[model samples]
Target: MLLLLLFLSLPPLSAAQLCHPNDLAALLAFKNSFSNPNSSLPSWDPQFHCCNWYGVECNDTTNRVLGLDIASVDLHGTIPPSLSKLHHLQRLRLHKLPNLVGPIPPELGQLPLLGYLVISWTNISGPIPSFLTNLRSLSYLILSFNRLSGPIPPSLPSLPYLYAIDLSRNLLTGPIPESFGHFLLSTALDLSHNMLSGDIPASLGNVNFSRIKLSRNKLSGDASVLFGKDKVADTIDISRNSFEFDFSKVGFMESLDVLDISHNKIYGSIPKQITEAVYLQFLNVSYNRMCGEIPTGWKLKYRSESWDNSSFFHNRCLCGVPLDPCK
Candidate 1:
């Protein structure tokens, strides 16, 4: 009768009890807040288990929710704070929810296990929550293409494992934190297409980013740190800024493939150092105050069409293989 008693005491494993009661309640609360016209959560019914729901994943042993990815689902309405109840949640992606408005709920900081948080292409606005710094396990964070404004929280760089941050195409203003160099293993850092102004932090050169896009901002000053020695950045786009560095600084980027520093106040001759970039594919230094001969790099040699000519045009006095002779 001991085995019979144990079996009788076990919870039912039917569809009626598909998920942990607390997780189910949280999911229901989350679903109730959104206007899901497409019926993305048709299976999100109390009669069935939440583990079987459209965008939910649960751990097999403990039955705790582990991942929730409802990206690009046309989810409208603010994120429900009840989601913090899922203590086991490790990866949460709610990207491209253009209709989801309002500030990111501070309740997200309560998720102790969250490692990857991607909420890009949303209409969420307000200052990035400082509580995010408390989430030490966070590694990949992409909050790009949103209406989020205010200076990026400096506490973010202090996150021990954070390796990627993309806040581009937003209304974010103010200087980028010099502490950004603390992301020792970061591969990509993009803060482009914002209203951010001030000198590009020289400390950014300390980290070895593979791609750095600070284009179309109001940034100015000596950007030499970005391309100077120890820079392992391969693709860099700082175009349409007020940076006044000489073109010669680009020589250090031997691994560069795409370089667009156009429409800046940069001047001086197109130095031979740039030719050292054997991997250069796309080069646009146009619309600047640069003068003298275009380097005889293999990529710039046999180019045709006005677009090619346009790349070297609008400068003070550029001539050679690409453009017509200096007059």
Candidate 2:
């Protein structure tokens, strides 16, 4: 009779407690630390429940926070540690928040159900958290336009279902990880405008991609590493780097639509392969140490500015087409 009486007295677990109650309190504590200059996040009042807060959504059935979408809110201050409390969170969007600063909390990797994470255009610095690889269910990740630095994490290739990745406009350095070849289903991979150095990873030539950008870095080596067996569409910008190679030897040059290798140290005669790229719309090999007869082609005539530089002066051995024949 005593055991039965004790069971009857215990309070049942409610759906509101799907996750720990302290999770809610933690988010509230974070709000307390920052100054909301615009009063835009007024929904973060202490008296009201978190479910009523702006940019936060809860599942109706479990009353658990499921989504946090705060794009372009001009929100300033560091990301709150309390967010890890939302164990059921599926989407976290915090784009265009220029005032957002500090490293992304590695604790965020604990969200098992997270699918979409967009934190672009912030001032967040430091290496990408390795813990983020724990989000096995994530599909879209955009960390573009930030102050993130360090080698690209090799673990990123483990994300089997990832479709798009944009890490452009940062201070990331180091060779492209060999594991990047594993992203067979990826549609876009943008690593442009970083301090990335070393030869383009040869493994990249094996993976299929819709768009690839490695422009404006200190990357070196031949251009042949990009053209895999598959036909890639969109742009290829390796421009503004120190790539040194014989353009005549490049293999499978027909797949690209836009190829820009300007401002490099490349040399040798333009190859006949240039005419084979029938779909080529934009080609800029200007300001390189290239010489010999210019390859006669459909679009080559219009790219005068790309080829009219003093570097061509050293190649006095020969020239023709748009340029005065070597005196």
All models, RMSD in angstroms: 3.2, 6.7
Q: How many backbone clashes does candidate 1 have?
A: 1
Model 2 clashing-pair count? 1
lDDT string, candidate 2, 26-89, tens digits: 6566566456833747777655667777887888776677888887776668877767777788
lDDT of all predictions, in order shown? 0.82, 0.75
Question: Across residues 141-195, which tens digit of lDDT does each residue of candidate 1 receive?
Answer: 8888999999989888888888788889889999988888667575688899999
TM-score of each: 0.89, 0.75
